[model samples]
Target: MSKTNLPNESIETYLIRRRALMRLGAMAGLGAALPGLRAQAQAKPATPLQFVGWQYNPQIVAQNVETFEQLYDENVNYQLIPGEYAPITETMLVAGKKFDMMYSEEATLARWITAGWAQDVDSMPDVAAIKASMVPVGVRNLSLPNGKLGGLPYYAGYGSFIYNEKHLDQAKLQPPTSWAEFLEQARQLKKDKIVEFPYVSAWAHQAPSFSWSLFSIWYSEGAKVFDANFDPVFDDKFTSVLEMHRTLYRERLVSPDIFTLPQEGVPSYATGQHTFAVIHDYDQKVLNDPKLSQCAGQVRNAIMPGATRSTFSWVSMYLMGAGAADPDRAWNLLRFFGGKAKDGQYHVIKRWALQFGLGTPYTEVMNDPEVAASFKSWKDTDVALQQLQNSTPRDVGKTLWYQDWDWYMMGAVQDYIRGSQPTSALVADLHKQVGVFKARYAT
Candidate 1:
């Protein structure tokens, strides 16, 4: 297999640095770039700032990079890592690669900071303004374990409950306000033959959306998976949640193929094959788009159902690499992408929101009339934003071993669903596993 195919490869097998796999740009002399670091107006060397990110929208990224280059006269050598972005980037870093800025996910941020690959931005001059610009959850997600701001948001959003209004209306049912109600509604739809599977989910093991859906349900039911001490505390509420899944699967209310599906089962809802989904807020844009979804005009958003009506939120970021040779230049680039640019406007972040339906951390961007108007094209602005307020970041993400634990948890969940383990056994095993990881990563 190609080195880029590492996502499916075992983590232990690829931990070693493979120089042949890296495609980084040439490194520049720190002394030569020091002047440019002090101020954008200062004389600079010919070397470009090295910036790297995973493939998402390379054309948009290139356009934004070109705009940054034009606006600041800063040279940037931008590169895209093809697969398993964090592991590849970490391998590159371990191999002594240097870059000014890189994309980071919340699950990997703690590990990056712990390994000294990322620099905390709390000491930056614009830190206060940047913090003020973002939502509370964004700030929390971007912060290091030490409470220092680790980076700025590339995008921040929450998992939300989305439903097909057409199906509900056809069944003469209202949108659900609680898990009990939700299950009843699903049954009604299924019984009426509105759809074979009235509910759909992206619960495939090892899929990122699985974690999002798992936590969103846990939170909606007021279950804290972990305590402040980083211990697993989800045992009490986990049985009900797990049972809910079992009931759905056994009764044929949810698709039997959901275990293998990817990403919120968008096509199931879009094509009107399913009535309900719990997906990230941005996906609503796709789910409701006229060109993309057959249920375009029928899809609508609702805050997740439960007593608290809560869900899990998260952020991906633009982190300043500790290995950045030109700290100020790197900060400028990070700010340009994650915060406001020299023009005092959030050009890139705003574009990510308005153009792509991605969420933003900036209060101004979130409240922008244009942004709200844009959301109205695909989703309810109030429900979407309200869901943001009701969302909370996963505390376990602060651990260096979070990704490892998350992977194990996903497999365990799958086992539980398959009846390979009982609820008590599953919860006990999960807690024991958390303790093992905690002990292994202890200071």
Candidate 2:
């Protein structure tokens, strides 16, 4: 028997036949749509990469982690860690433990690379991209003493003489061109009662694993701790640098407690207690925090008065890490963090992140019309750019070379000068303490 004959017999059968054909057409339409849906389903998740760093704020890391995770493939999990910068350094020092990304200052980088804690970064395919992304002063200096790119570039800030700009303007004085001019200006500012105190520079704690900021001022003074062959030559310039601090201290520009300020007198400076301060180019943004500073934008940056160098500067340098299981994927994360991409996501993320005070590192991003225009609202963008172009590298070994001798020296400087404690006495005290590290571990 033919089943078709039976199906056509009923009153409802005629309607069913028409409905079946319509269902077939719908099936065909779905088939047409299936290819794109299949492609979407089959697409690979972005490879998982780990980025570990010292997020200065916990809340920031939490918010950005969600965004970063969403930006990558759903299968890719991104974790952001917030902690001290030094721990990240120590983590990198651990052999064979992979960190997809990390950051450090130039001096710490020198030590890590010197001690074989860091891998050769030239092996990365994104070296060219890093070069393109980073500023000249920030990354190119990596090849100086070590002959390897130690770290990727991050934000580079100027080491300027910070001051109450109103005071300088009121006194009809321009920013000084040299230390002599700095002292002379200090005296004038003091005499004019424009500043309650002369000038003091107090850096944050064992910061950046070193005192490269002070090195910047010393380099500006045309001083070096080592000769061309890298022999230790701590002599006249070292004493001169020491004496300059003493001169400022003696002049009462620096408070008695300035030598050991934990907040580096940011609290005092923000309160308008000082006429001048020596601080990083970024200090303006930091000190201007509404909760911390009353003076706010009144404090501004000027070129650090030095001997010869344009501006000896220290800055944070970030690098793509070795031992990443996915080097290419890791580079993508770095590129994203470095802020070089033209994509809207990058622009939005960087602008937002910078609001938390971590400045963008890339030229394309920093100079992006949108980002640049916004930055100009705060300061003379052109002048800041010009100053950035005018940076000098800190020596990695010897004098201004790697790590925290200057910080140790800065700490000891107070007792040595004020209490009539000799340099030999300070050195003797340090000899029993830090000298062992210098000799045992000095690279």
Candidate 3:
């Protein structure tokens, strides 16, 4: 069989054609189900498909599963793996467990593909449509080096500046348009006593939050931690990035409690204690919830400030296991989660985005009027799309040793933030550690 080619269209043209296709498919009684997938579903009785992923929301997952079962007549045994997702997934795959469908991130997917554990998603019948439906970041992450599709892009979380608009108003300040402007505003907020701490860091001593905070600054400044050869390339640009954070710590503009805060700086921003924060897309949703946040309706999302507006991009993907008992049924189920249904809706990813504030990579869903209307902040979706456009793929794509590299870097950053290590010493140590990791892990 030949490989499927996805349509490449501008945002406007894509939306127009997508809408037309939906109408045409519905009128012809075809529904939005992929052609070959719909036929396969009707030919067989429902069978149980084991699905695993990190926890999203229990109720939301249950609702989606229930809907999927009713629509396709398939039973889904969905499990939310506990503890760190990457390590847990690695253990399961290494142990040779059978999972028909698995939820994964781009980094984890890269490792799994290299280990020969992931099935090429391009073999699925709907590959063309799926590719065309997603944004560039999704396409780049899910497609492997040989041009084979590795996974179905589910949802993406991009970094952005989420701030308390009410606090900024009180201080007679606007959201900063550039990195220099951001520094100026931080100083102004402190001078005017707008908030005790104008900025908060989610620099927790762990995989996700630590890396998320570090990369938000690193990428926004247009710096790369690793070169094409996967060698650690520490330069003045990297030094400048670290020094920017050091300055914030020295000036007391950032919360000192960040060192011990396991919740990733949400408390500071949600309580209106800090006027500004760098946070993921979902963090924006959390801060907008009136029941969960003191700032609730007053929160707004802005593009990250820097010489070039760039931020870290994360993807949650759906992969077919290499050892699947039923590849056909597995493909059907995977399509159910990532593809549009008979009603022209992406039930799972759409609900996930609405319940949480994370962005879906599906172009149609992202631009849907109803979905846009559901966000508390009018600009949230727009800012998210903009960030995704300018995003750098999660660093794992650049190197398989991302987990090790991140561990060493996070430790050094923690020490530097706490004044246990100076900037010069931290830079030197980073170079040394990267060299060590490369020697150990590089093939």
Task: Give the number of the best model, judged by lDDT.
Answer: 1
Clashing pairs in 1: none
Candidate 2 overall lDDT versus native: 0.55
On TM-score, the leading prediction is 1
lDDT of 1 at 345: 86
lDDT of each: 0.77, 0.55, 0.70
Per-residue lDDT over 337-412 for candidate 2, one digit per residue giving the tens place of the 0 to 100 score: 5544325456334644356333444576676676776565445566566666776666544222334555565566
Q: Which regions of candidate 2 fall more than 4 Å away from where they truly are?
A: 1-48, 74-84, 87-97, 113-118, 141-146, 203-205, 208-210, 287-292, 341-349, 352-361, 397-401, 404-407, 421-439
Clashing residue pairs in candidate 3, if any?
A: none
lDDT of 1 by residue, 76-185 (tens): 76766755677777898888887788888887787887888887889988798779878887898888878899888899878889888988988988889999999998
**TM-score ranking from best candidate downward:** 1, 3, 2
Candidate 1 runs further than 4 Å off:
1-44
TM-score per prediction, in order, is 0.89, 0.74, 0.84
RMSD of each: 7.4, 19.6, 11.7
Query: In candidate 3, how many Å is residue 212 off?
Result: 1.2
